[model samples]
Target: MDEHSTAAESINPKHQALIDRLSTRRSATTTSSDTARPVADFLSSFASSKLSIEQSLSESRSRADLDHISSLDLDQSSFDSASSSLLPRKKFSFRNKPQKKEEDPKNVAEISVEPSAIDKISSLSVRDGPGFRNEKDTTLVKDFRQCDVGQGEFTLSDLENCRVYLKGTVRALFFYRIRNCQVFTGPVLGSVLIEDVSDSLFVLASHQIRIHHAKATDFFLRVRSRPIIEDSNRVRFAPYRLTYEGIEDELKESGLGEETGNWANVDDFKWLRAVQSPNWSLIPEEEWLEIADISQCK
Candidate 1:
């Protein structure tokens, strides 16, 4: 109480006021520090997150650059050119060319004949127009039926629709017999002609025949005055070297000659005679005798 009491007694009111002011300042500083610590912690956490995002983007770009550089094979110039070429050229090609053209055809030869031999067909049966008439008579010739001619052995089987060639004149006398018969003529005559009669039933004829081609002989006969049967025959005629035997002898007597051959080469007039028969041997003019060159007979 002696010294301390004496100092306390000496304190002023202004000093007390200064002490209170210092106390309020200290309280304010403590509150400001508490608020600043939370704000600073929030700013630091935001900066760390931004730095992580940037690092991830930088790593991704670097990897892409490395991958591009590693894929190239720089040793091969052609391969490198194909890979690194900025502008590429596109190629194109075509196939299957067109073809060329062809050629044409030509002509051949002519035939020989006489003025009379070249005569047009007088009459025949036609299938197209009105004159369409059937055969007036039809006659069947059996096997071994003897024809009027003395031609060598011939079969009736050989006489059905055969073609023949004759080299002789078709006289008016023959037409008299043919016209009297109910025989049809027109289209048939267009391709052939009937000439002089060799017998009562058989006669001289010419059909589409050629000795070179050896075409058979053909003839039509009548039954009941109407054509009912067609005769045909395979014959070889060698008139050039014909020797008078039986049929050949009769043929010679009938004004046909060995020199004339089966076909008469009379200048352009190649006269031919087509004959039909069941049996040529039965006929006096055509007795069964061998006519030479049967192989060449048309």
Candidate 2:
């Protein structure tokens, strides 16, 4: 008591109180929070409230590795690699009309005939875009859940007799040589280009649309601007009829939050007359499909 009381009295009361508070906090943190934590325990607690960036990145990389490993197709044949690939890398050979001697024969395609404000989007490199190319007779589904594209172009080409679903937002969409297929997609924030399509059904939303050399097809659309058809015919138009989970958020993000009733306002570039263009007609309400629910398709 003599030695202990002498040492205790040497420390000030305020300093002793601070020392006790610090000891309690360090003990509580180390024992209750800094140690083992339940991965799924999301209750309001220090462990759940703040996560370190290194820990978050480590978890993300681990989850990605697991997903990649789980999605590996063990039964995929060698032909699978040759048949389907990202669009930008594939070569699309569309022969131009060769009107003049100066035009290169490489068939440089995609920008519409009469350019507009969106022509600047041409700077988006096709090779850098994400898409599906050289696929046929198979079901294709793309759910843009993570918002991977930013004013990026997407393409679907050389497809036939397939049910394709694209649910998300994109800057531009291109459909080339699609036949006897049913294409359902989300909002094209910029423009949609369709070339050489026939006997197909398309439900799309876009700011602008251009169809060339299409025949006997049906279109359900929501357009912010007048849609143009260069050489298309027998196409029917109706209101856009495609839906999926989280689509409202995607549409809102892409500036297609509201229906503009412009699907029927199609302008035929070839038919500039006072009379209605015979190439396109309105689909009777009786024949119009229900708002297609692609949420279950995938």
Candidate 3:
């Protein structure tokens, strides 16, 4: 045999059989158009299937994204509708109307009695309390010396041309619509509220003092905090000059024993400028009264 035949004979039968089968298939594919057609058909079918699967996955992802965006838009719209339902909308109108001329300050002053009118309205609603109220052209006196500690709030309201005296410690004091009166009181532990008081003199000690709508009033105050006034005119302040038996003890107990020198510290809310407020002034020493002896006042 020749060398090629001898090598083929030395190969294993199984491997030799596989080699021969492959060589026959290759030859058939090259020679016959029918056999090549089937291979081409298979490759084309596999490529088309892969493309269809990729397109389906991309379309599904796009649909999911669109659904998610729509859901978010729906949720935002729902929230906006709910909030709008809870709050009423305010409407603004714009019109070119003639501007009104400013009124004279003097004319405004002539109409300034509105505060007294308002005070009348409030006086109509005033209820009787622990202290004197609605007394006209009278003198009233109350001795709180034997009362309990932290004796409840006291009120002197709607009194005109009266002399009022309160002795000993009280929790709070309220004076309203008092006209042409002299009011003397012992130490107030809490606060003193005065409103619509005109042409009056007050000698009191308190933790806080607030005067409102008062005209031509004088305050002799020993207050822990700076005294404040609003809408008040021609008010004057001086050191507290009120004296009665046991007043020192009452002052000490109410934490006002020392002269804190806060009496002259007046703040007028209506006058916020750097200049001295026209609403209040410090009473000259000569004009200051001597310590009022309220022990005998009744």
| lDDT (tens digit, per residue) of candidate 1 on 1-298 | 5533333233323334433543443344345565444334533543464355334433444545434433421234542353223222233545665655443223222233322421322232222321112222343221111323222211111122222222212211112112122221111111122332122222222222111111132222111111111121232221122221243433344343223222322111222345433222112235323332222222
Question: On a 0 to 100 scale, what is the lDDT of residue 94 in model 2?
Answer: 60
Query: What's the true lDDT of residue 140 in model 1?
Result: 29
Error of 1 at 36 (Å): 66
Query: Candidate 2 residues 112-141, lDDT tens each?
Result: 344652343332233335777778889998
- Segments in model 1 whose C-alpha atoms lie over 4 Å from true places: 1-97, 100-250, 253-298
Candidate 2 Cα errors over 4 Å, as ranges: 1-128, 147-151
Instruction: Write candidate 3's Cα lDDT for 1-298 as tens digits.
Output: 6533333343334333533543454455645565555444544553464355434434444556434433433233553454334323335666877789999998898888556656563654544568788888888888887665347888888899999989888999988789999999999999998878899999989999999889898999999999999988999999999898888988998999999999988989988799999778999999998988888765
Instruction: Please give the ranking of all candidate structures by lDDT, highest first, separated by commas.
Output: 3, 2, 1
Give the Cα lDDT of each candidate.
0.27, 0.71, 0.76
What lDDT is reached at residue 52 by model 2? 35
Q: Give the candidates in order of TM-score, highest first.
A: 3, 2, 1
Determine the C-alpha RMSD for candidate 1 after optimal superposition of all C-alphas.
31.5
lDDT computed for candidate 1 = 0.27
Sliding window of 10 residues with minimal summed lDDT for model 3: 67-76
Pick the winner on lDDT between candidates 2 and 3. Answer: 3
Better of 1 and 2 by lDDT: 2
Q: At residue 283, what lDDT does model 2 achieve?
A: 98
